[model samples]
Target: MKREIFVVADNIFTPLGKTTAENFENLKQGKSAIKQHHNAALSRQPFYAALFDKKEFPKEDRYTKFEQIVIASITDALQQSGLNTSDEKTVFILSSTKGNIGLLETETHTPELFDRISLSASAKLIAEYFGFKNQPIVVSNACISGVVAIITGMRLLRTGQYENAVIAGADVISEFILSGFESFQALSPGVCKPFDKDRDGLNLGEGAGTIILSSNPKYAGNIKALGGGISNDANHISGPSRTGKELSLAIDQAMKDADLSIGDISFISAHGTATSYNDEMEANAIALSGLESVPLNSLKANYGHTLGAAGLIESIVSVQSLKDHVVLPTMGFEERGVTRSVNVAKSIAASSKPNFLKTASGFGGCNAAIVFGK
Candidate 1:
């Protein structure tokens, strides 16, 4: 039998929640983390984005903002994990789309501050903070990086090499990201409306979620990632296919791993990027999975789009939701769009204890999904 994977402990998600309990409370209350960007700080750009309020963090001019986010997220996750220095059985993995973009900025425009923030530094700082002796694996698979990290951790644990591991994913707002997406014309000017008929584009977000995983019975928890899948469309790097073949295969594989059929899945967490192509592709894929009408929600509705960190944050949310026997609302979904089927928008209630099938597709033809349990 495949060893079971459970989220032993997790901190209150930030930028998404004030604390874990507070966040979970909001999820139970059916409140959403997504909001309109009213801050005039954003340069005159068409795309609005979800920004973490860093004022709550310790005021620091020395470290980059991305570094601050990393520290905050990782420390909180480790604290919740209740891991001591003696817990040598744990491994570490870091995933991000834009690692230390602020550092890259400094390196480009302000060389003096460049030393403090770098991609390797991002990984190193987290590993050093945990005082882990093993080198952490760093993955940057555009948007699917977070789910990839969890899958990698599962493989490691399955190999009987480690008993526990921490998968921490973080990213932050940066000038480069705003400019890059704007250049691609993928940025939305206001709050995103995924699967909505009038949906224009995606609004970027900044935040992170960390999960502590273990096969040991000691770390009992509410949510467990039962299993999931990954597949690439290869039809287009940025645009999704009308057929949604790659994504459908991923869902099928993930269900198989969890030893569940499509009928066993009670709900789904759609990638729902709000872009016309992405949303339509997801709907088509869900229909292809033979889960044409499973209850579904999009974390992008709550967190904007966190890019690489997206999968992990959404996965954590699904775990919490399943555990609480509640479903989060699809915040910005206003109307149905042009798609085949399987676009869910509801404050769902579980008939049989809900197990969420979370799915995502990213740049470079990468797609991933996981089946998580209560």
Candidate 2:
């Protein structure tokens, strides 16, 4: 029999709150952290985002903001799991689209700084802090990094090479990030509205999320990582596939791996970035998978787009939703704007099904899907 992987513990650290429970509570109360900011350091023009107070984290010469959030999230998850990281069977996987990229603003371009900005180096430093015995793995596949990291960890555990996997992802908002999106005109002027008719663009946010997965059955009831699938559209460098068939392929593979039928999935946690193309593409994909009525919601309005941290944070919320037997609404969604029909959640509702699907798409035509269940 294949080894079972369960979510032993998890944590989400964002402007909304520090802990998972706190974040969930804030979501339930319909509170959002996104607001307008006039920070000249990030952008010349005003922008909207969910950002942590600069006072909360003082200038630190040791670790960058990205690393600091990752460490904080992993620490809380480890504490909750009570797992010893010093063991040889425990491994760490770090996910981020941009790690230490902000250092370029202050530091000069030099060969010595190369190693410092490398994602692997950041992963090693974090692993050493927690005393992880094995070499750390790093995933940097655009926005799908977090889900890919989880899937990679699950495969590693199934290979019997590791007993526990500490998966965490984070990215901090910087001038580099904001300007890149701005160049593409992908930033919404105000709050984002996923799957809504008036949805324009995505709002950028910064945060971290950590999930610990173990092969032991002792961690069972919380939820299990049933299966995952990844694919690429090869459509455009920054744009997703126009047809949504690639993402549908990924969703099909995940369901096949999980040994589930369409009816088994209770709902979908979409990667609804509130961007015009992304939300529309996701709707087409769901319809392709015959899941147009699955009742899905995007958490972008609650937390904004956390980039590399989005997949993990959204997955954590999906788990919580399943456990609590409620599906949170897609905030700011009013009318259907996509070409295809979709059951875009408008209000909180009960969910009795044991399984849920999470999907994500990012730059470079990458798409990923994962199924989690009781």
Candidate 3:
């Protein structure tokens, strides 16, 4: 019997705030977290990025700079969830491209030092923090890591393997990731402007987000998984397909799983990376869905591209938009870059009622779509 999963409390550590509500408000107001990085921690990169202030994360674990943020965010989510961690049956799943690569970047000459930054390594560290007994699993699917973790959690719950789960995704800024994007020419010199005529590339941001899920009828979580769909483009490892076929398939599957039709969808949370391929592909997918009137928005402009953490962070933010009854605008959009049949939101509103589709495409020919509603 596949039990249902409901999100009780979700929290995010973003440039916007230490809390999910604050982060959503920032995104709704069209706030951009893509400020220039001025710290001395990163010296090899030439481009600026939206980075978190170290002083703001003193409560985070010191093992790595990112650990601290994830831990703090987890604390907030769990506090809001009112989950009983003492149950011992709760599982932990972490999604991240480079879980603790910050430690590995320093150990390049010593390959064995990779253990220090392994995905499982950091997951164990986080599990211990919550006193969780189960062996935590790590989902390292590049950019799709977060949504993949959520999907994995839903499966576990539906399978009756675990009564509840904590889904956490996080990635911190490091020379390792910075260098990778730089090598790919995916880093924007200034703030990212998604779906804009002159948009260049994505600005990177770091943060962790956690969602607590449970099958218990008593759980107070608002949004349920309803249904989600996932697929890979196979067009390229790093770039998306020209036709957006795979992305379209993912959305179709999710709606099917929910037993919903295209007309049932209200809006979409776009992956809007501000990169030429990402935004174009997403816009085309929305058009193919035949919901051109449905509004679309992106976070790359507000929080930069958070990589793995983006899946959970953005999904959690979507829920906030639903719960808080506010819709944030996409910042940095001046002119439409693509000739698509979709409507791009130019302003934020106090409230909206349409179901939200959170779509994410990543570096490994992987993609995922999650639909949520009140």
Residue pairs with backbone overlap in model 1: 12-19, 12-20, 34-302
On residues 1-374, what C-alpha lDDT tens digit does candidate 2 reach at each position? 67889999999999998999999999999989999999999999999999999997897667778889999999999999999999999989999999888888878999888889999989988998899989999999999999999999999998999999999999999999999999999999999999999999999999999999999877766689999999999889888898999999999999998888889888999999999999999999999999998999999998999999999999998998999999899998999999999999999999899999999999999999999998
Checking candidate 3 for backbone clashes, the offending pairs are: 2-158, 3-158, 8-221, 28-328, 60-68, 61-68
For candidate 2, what is the lDDT? 0.93
Models, CA RMSD each? 2.5, 0.9, 2.1
Higher-scoring candidate on lDDT, 1 or 3: 3
Worst 10 residues of 1 by lDDT: 38-47
- Where is the poorest 10-residue window by lDDT in model 3? 37-46
Please give, for residues 177-290, the per-residue lDDT of candidate 1 as tens digits: 777787888877777788888888888888777887888866555466677788988788777776888988998888898888776776788888889888888888888888
lDDT of 3 by residue, 214-269 (tens): 87777635677766788988778778888877888888887776676776665678
Winner by lDDT: 2
Better of 1 and 3 by TM-score: 3
Model 3 lDDT at residue 55: 81
Estimate the TM-score for candidate 1: 0.91
